[model samples]
Target: MLERLDDIDWERLGHAYGTAEDVPEQLRALRSPDAAIREKARWQLYGNIFHQGTRYEATAYAVPFLLELLADPATAEREELVGLLAAIAVGYDEQWLPDGLPIAEHRQQAAGGAELLAAAPHPGDDDFDEDEGDAEYLASLSEDDQDRLYTHVVVAAYDAVRAGVPLLRTLLASEHDLELRVMAGYALSWFPEEAEGSLPVLAGAVTEALEVGATAADGPDHTVLAATALVAIGLLGGAPDPALLDDRRPLVRWGAAIGLARAHGPRADPAVAAELLGWAGGESPSDDRVPFLDGDLAGFAGQALAQLGAGRTVETFDALLRRIPAVSGVEALHVVGEALKLAFPGGALTGDVPFDALDERQRRLVRQLADHEQVWRIDGSYFGNFRLLIGEYGLPDKYVTLRSYAGQG
Candidate 1:
């Protein structure tokens, strides 16, 4: 399928590593009959071209080949390939979310960066370590060079993955593999520009999911398929079919609520906001992680609230306060961090301040946290991010110090 794979000069391009010469072999290995070999190559791609959501010059070049592999019927791990393309296109979903991808801004920055880079002198080989990777080489560059190069490569990678959105749309019709369709739908959500063509396909997928959910009562849970499509519909600037908001499955209902809230904003039904708040409260927790919002439904709800500009609301604050004591795992980290940021904007807390000096919001937050000491008593690893987040706001990161600061000690 990749007949012209060797035509490109991979060695000239750079990924997260030094050179992208290894990318070609990794691409070829994706078609390997041995699962282990294919998996090893997948990890190689993840660790190099798309390392930690940082796309590189070689990332753009890899897009077409990855799409080809995903399109090939014989290819394995096509789902993972779809996810990789999504990651390359938008990095983390939260970065551009609430307010979707700033395509115009990015395009402008990329154009400006291209101009700046075109006139700028390229760094000499001596400026880099002999064994330095692309990231290290980037670190050695001037701030302007760094921004220029980053914008240049990032936008290129974004557009490269975007070119394959049509192909990704076709995967949504795969009848048997619901997960594959879900992943494709999730990937399609990032490309809002493709909304004109993709919206129909996504809406059709949701209809199909509804039909599946209706007749296949004894079959697998297809709620995710509907959820993904609804979420994508919202992300693409269209609200989902409003009736799905009352779907029997909580996840389906949550998805519809999130879609309505995102698409219609302040004009959305007030009930939708309440529904999302309920989800945000973690009232009926589930270990079943959906593909969207990092698989944490509660975290997704909380983030959606943040995106809706309701993060600072008294209702949101109270809901998050109630959610904290019971929350566990990495997902809670996002929820807690969101609550703290909304409560104490821009590091307003000081270690030396008396409790009376704090604002009502800050005092209320500290008092609630002080009351819920179990959140602090959880395993230390659970609060690694919690501590960092609290420290960022110039607040005490320990339970004892927090109680003292709240004058509750």
Candidate 2:
């Protein structure tokens, strides 16, 4: 791995910084005897190569080295290395989401995204066009730029990881470290075909966490890890046992509810969703945290609810509007805009049909959120997620998706 690393043109690659010339030093830090230094090295790589979960030009260059470290049995920081691979392959959302796009969806999107560029306006362009066909050439002009788009580069790197599922699969089934086991279980979940191996590992983690819940000292963060395993299982197309809602752990119940919805889609278990709606409101004090988000449980719940509502039934939509007060910060305006557009995807966007054409239940939800925009726009509190969307992948940032809606822009 070191020999291969030496041949790469690190100076030509760009991370958050202009050139990732220092990346080799960071990769070597992963081998440090001191645990603190190892952690620092990991953070440095994440900050530079995959800053804020947005993959850069250097991210793909680092993938093989990251995986090489994970494959080494002597590596003390196996858990961190495994996580770093997943982080690079797709990405992680430390703030709002538990993780990035599901493995299958991400793989499909990454595979399908041939010409999508992360950005087009070069440092010196007289007139940078934003349309898909227009800006493609901006990235195409670079040296050996087969994948002129940054997203395509990330996807190309992801393909390498896809070919290495067997390695990750082994890590899931046999790794003794709880964190590595848990992370590997989730990592395998990225590839739906690996469910045969992933399900049992995740299920076993849940059982261990349940047993540990009885004593509160069985393992480090057993509940959280178990819940994540459950989520990964669901993302891989397995439903969390409905009985998980009865568990004493709130996150377990939350994961079960949300995970079930994500796995089954429109056929989501109403019983499970009812639990999610209840938890979405977070009225029950036992529900201390939302499944994946870092801030207000109810707030992120609403975001999930809106996302679910977009593809599923209005029942999820009902959960979204029930707790607007729970929604706060920069995500509100973008989220509100999402609810309206998603409520009537095409009709509202094309202005072919009016918002009034929708049933009162859905229409009311649109008006409810739109009404708040007046205040958010003035305070500049709104569009926090909006700017992030445009800043990342303009067309689809997955945060403030302010799609045109119901005669409004």
Candidate 3:
């Protein structure tokens, strides 16, 4: 790895700081015996090379060295290295937003700062149809900004993974280290074309997770890694094992539901689909002092199911609506993403759900939101989708009172 580093013109390669000359030093520091120096080096490498999850020219160049570091027995904090590899490999997913959000304004709204606006639209308003490009509204920026930000990152990740797949597959198969193995699987999921090499290992991880989850009462030390393994397996087009779906552990069940949804979409096994729906509605299995419903399990499950366009679009939407503004609660956007997934398949979840051909209920939802005329506080593409749904499908007229929108601006 060091020999190869000498061949690259680091001055021309770009990370966040505009050049990659300093990256080699950070790579060497990974082998340092000084624990503090090694820690700082890893952080510096991550911040500059993989800054804000955006991959750069230097990122792909760094993958092989990262893998080499992972294989070396002399490396300290190997688990952290595995994590960095996963983060670097994972640039983003297809459903990922194309543009950055105005997070500052959203934060202000969440802090109770409201933006004055025209009176909310009522049912009998003059313009019942929510126009496509309201001058007052800003859509997910003209696709151009998104294209500029991510195209190279996607190319960089793909090029690196395409070359590194064989090495990662070997590492995943032969490594005795559990974290390294799990991370390898996670990284491979980012490159679906490499599934042939990674799926078997992911499948093995599922079996191992079932064993761990089955005996979770005895501490379940590896459940988190196991969950990551399961999710990775699912993302790589592997179906959830029956044993996993049937596992008594709620965590495994939640992960299994996500896997099945990814692998089979709505065509997933009847039992698996039912189980996923239960998860979407925030159900927990086996009472082993587990807190499945109290976390993002339901949120992820709901999103997957929404993508599948299953039976619970409205039911799931209602449940998500009920959970919003719960002072101390999970994210409402998770369910919003799910509701949009099902409610406006190929449209709603991404904020492109149209307003034409809508029945009364969808229309009413739009009208009611317009009546409030409050500036939207949420600033995600998903939130944009939710707003479109209000205009497209029309949220219920009483939507505001239905869930507290306080701190939601």
Candidate 4:
């Protein structure tokens, strides 16, 4: 399957860490009989080619080899293999969640770099001043040019993964490995361009999952397969069969409701909103590994509520408020962000205003969130996104500043 592994000039390609000459060896190790060796190779691959959601020049080159491993039935840990492809295609799904992958716009933006690519001098050209490497050359260019180049690389990686969507569809349809099928379902969700071919298989998976009662003899929650398929359908701009909403399983029902809410947006049935609100405030699914929203069903439900234009409603505000304390760090940040948006759309409460300036409900919501010390105390890499969101609303992102703004200090 990897006969051409050595044929590729991997040394010329670069990953997050350096020359990708070691990538071939890592790929070879994936087929090793030793589980520890395979796992070590997997982490090495992740750290290098697709490190921290940033796809490198080598990432696109590695896609076919990874897909080949996935296709080989003898491959161990096929789920992780498919997941790595998904990560390479889209760095972090959270950035695209509830709205799905912007495949057309992304491709358009990537193609806009054609002029840059054309004008770029070859290695032999006098103007080819990238003596240090691609990084130095990129640093020498204007920010716009740098963005275009990076976007080009990213899109190349994404398209490479997209090329394997048909294979992912096949895997999704296969019943032999339910976990792998579910992983494929999540992976397919990122390739909205392949929706025409993927949706049918995903729909079939939903039906198959339901027919199996989403259960196995050992008691793993096989319902996630159905839920994953439903969410993928919704992310691809399609809705699940409405009849499934009436299915007997709670998880299936949540999937149908969330999928409908995502696909239809504000036009979704009002009942779906009610269902999401309930789920958002209720206990999150026990399976922390459920694909979407990091398995925080409550967090996703809150985000979707905001999407449906129900964020302004008192019900959503209250539900999110109930959910905030139960979650911490980014999960709480997501819930609070939605709550803030719902309470004050279009960056309301940005001007100098006394506590009395806010309406009673807004004041109440702000006070509750401000007092939730858990969400406020978090600090680290993930906090930046939360800070940006809050800043847009003219809210202080720091705990002390927030307390002062809320008139607590």
Candidate 5:
């Protein structure tokens, strides 16, 4: 059966990647009594087969097998096994890890590797203070464990101020694992101030990832990481290359928007603001024109718009308000409100006048427009006076009366 399996068209398996029904045989082989057979089967299941599948299916099947491998004491070269396990962990949602998996173990492994690189003499050694405590911690872990620990530490340290700067600088110059290098670029997000020196290299990594084509969604991790780093660089008030905003991937575009928002100061370019507005309004005017606004992309875009300040016009404000009502759930509302407050606080209202100044007829209209359960909520107060009025107004029919007073003020 194993020999026949080898001859079977593996390409056909790619098409079958997502269906849970086809997984049992692969799972059985992964647990085979023969170590070689088990290892081979597991490798095929995750590396070749799983990588080719949709993210949902790949994660569902690969996670259990990876966790079992991690739990098995018999798996040799524990460092290598754990490193592979960490790679697998990256593949699955972080929420899936078992309670005792020792996140610290992964961190230690990543940190240990970085310390080895840091120990090597370099030109910028004078700029960084050597901490004896940190050095001692790195020394305590095994060399193999050290590599793993160092990689994770690099990932973590990227979030810190003093630690991330020198570490990112060192990683960018070193010829280490491509994945670790990619992770270092991600870690750069915490140190936006230092991003001026790092952005070009990070962009190169993103370009390379695009060139390599899709291997895993993990493949796009580097691009996302680099794009995020670019955003940080922009936030620290540095100008970013506008071309970064035109990447084929929406994630990359989202990152560029965030970076531009961060960089936009008192005299921000109008073109930049317009481009961001275009993204929020979607590419076209049709009902189906809603852009992909989920996960980091939505949050980043919303926050970026807010950072653009009072430049948004009345039309833009009305469009955004309409979007607020159409958007589902409280979280979406929160994002829309936040963006509106940041960019067009006064414009977010139904009419130009303040809520307190509206006459009895206008107030009644406002209340009617606010009647929709989805649009009305007490917590809408965060958006200031305007969002509050919209939340108060329940009926769309009364909007005309409200609009008349709104246009006058």
Candidate 6:
């Protein structure tokens, strides 16, 4: 049977293309000569091809196979099979079984399957349970095992928000594994209003995170979670204290920036906004000795400044613009530049109009500044470059010399 099944033209089924015409042939092929062949055919037809078809085709062919998979324990690669079934269920909205199946039996079977997947035993464990003590027991496992347990719980929570949130909240509140708490906090963000009451809990977690010195260098997930929770709290109408923004820890500072940006309101204190603008301008006291600034924090500050209209002054605008080019990465630079452009209408270099239009002495200052021989050679070169590109095509040598001389001095 296996050899014959192997020989069958598994690849030739027109259903592979996911067209309606292919559905009947694919359904017929589902009863292939070998069980393995049948499973493979059903897996591809229902899981992949059927999902792409129209609602009617999906309901007719795909739903039945997924429903069957949802009930069949014999199909024991639990995780992969469960994931595929969930995808089908979500894709086609097959929350209830087809007409012929008794509703009660269908509900029981589906719930059993979901629960089994949701509460799957850790690889090293002999048994798993969904009873009261199970969570406590799972929570007490070794760090690696606890991580695995949380992963399963989080996936389950993601699938069924109703069941998932409470479990996740419990995990968020109780897990000693900072990683698990971070994961729960992140997972909680997906169901914002449902996780609304958890805001204080999450905030407390972030506050504790700060107390413990959580840093971005720790890991991306940790940084994202800490940042996300802060943003989440702000979204929930929580007011963040300004002191949170000036925390001694960089992670907390970055998170506060993200939170404050999201919390856009008239209530944002001008003092705090001024401080954020100062941070973006690279005037924050901590920046003087720090090897580098947090590009994300700097970008957030620029955004907040623009939103608050703090980039009005030439000095302030130039300072913010300077930070844009100084940012380490392209994405960071783009974000800061965008905010700068929005806040300071004309570009970063806009300075006060010359008190008196370029006079001979002022023109001389410009020339000195432009000439390479000037004390500030780079400044002269900058003006020289600008003059070559923007100044009139040709001017007298004395004018050019004066321009260079002025710029140099």
For each candidate in the order shown, give its overall lDDT on alpha carbons: 0.77, 0.60, 0.56, 0.79, 0.44, 0.43
lDDT of 1 by residue, 240-327 (tens): 8788777878878888988887888767776777877897776556434366757777777776776565533677777787788776
- Compared with the true structure, what per-residue lDDT tens digits does model 4 show for residues 284-338? 7435556777777788887787768744387888888888777666687678777
Question: Which parts of model 6 have CA positions greater than 4 angstroms off?
Answer: 1-164, 214-228, 282-295, 309-319, 328-337, 340-409
TM-score of 4: 0.89
Q: For candidate 2, write residues 101-159 as lDDT tens digits.
A: 55454445444345444444432244444233233564555543433355576676666
- Per-residue accuracy of model 5 over 158-189 as CA lDDT, tens digit each: 22222334544455435234544544554343
When superposed on Cα atoms, how far off is each prediction in RMSD?
A: 3.0, 7.7, 14.1, 3.1, 17.3, 20.7
lDDT of 6 by residue, 87-179 (tens): 332232112101111223323333333333345343224563323324555465566555444334333323443334565566566655554
Please say which candidate is ahead in lDDT: 1 or 6.
1
Query: Native-vs-model 4 lDDT?
Result: 0.79
- Full ranking by lDDT: 4, 1, 2, 3, 5, 6
lDDT accuracy of residue 189 in candidate 1: 89
In model 1, which regions exceed 4 Å deviation?
Answer: 115-129, 132-145, 286-289, 307-312, 345-347, 368-383, 398-400, 407-409
User: For model 3, what is the alpha-carbon lDDT of residue 164?
Assistant: 64
Give lDDT tens digits, candidate 3, residues 131-179: 4212232133345433433454545554555566776676666766666
Model 5 vs truth, CA RMSD? 17.3
| Residue pair clashes in candidate 4 | none
After TM-score superposition, the amount by which residue 313's alpha carbon in candidate 4 deviates from its true location, in angstroms, is 3.3
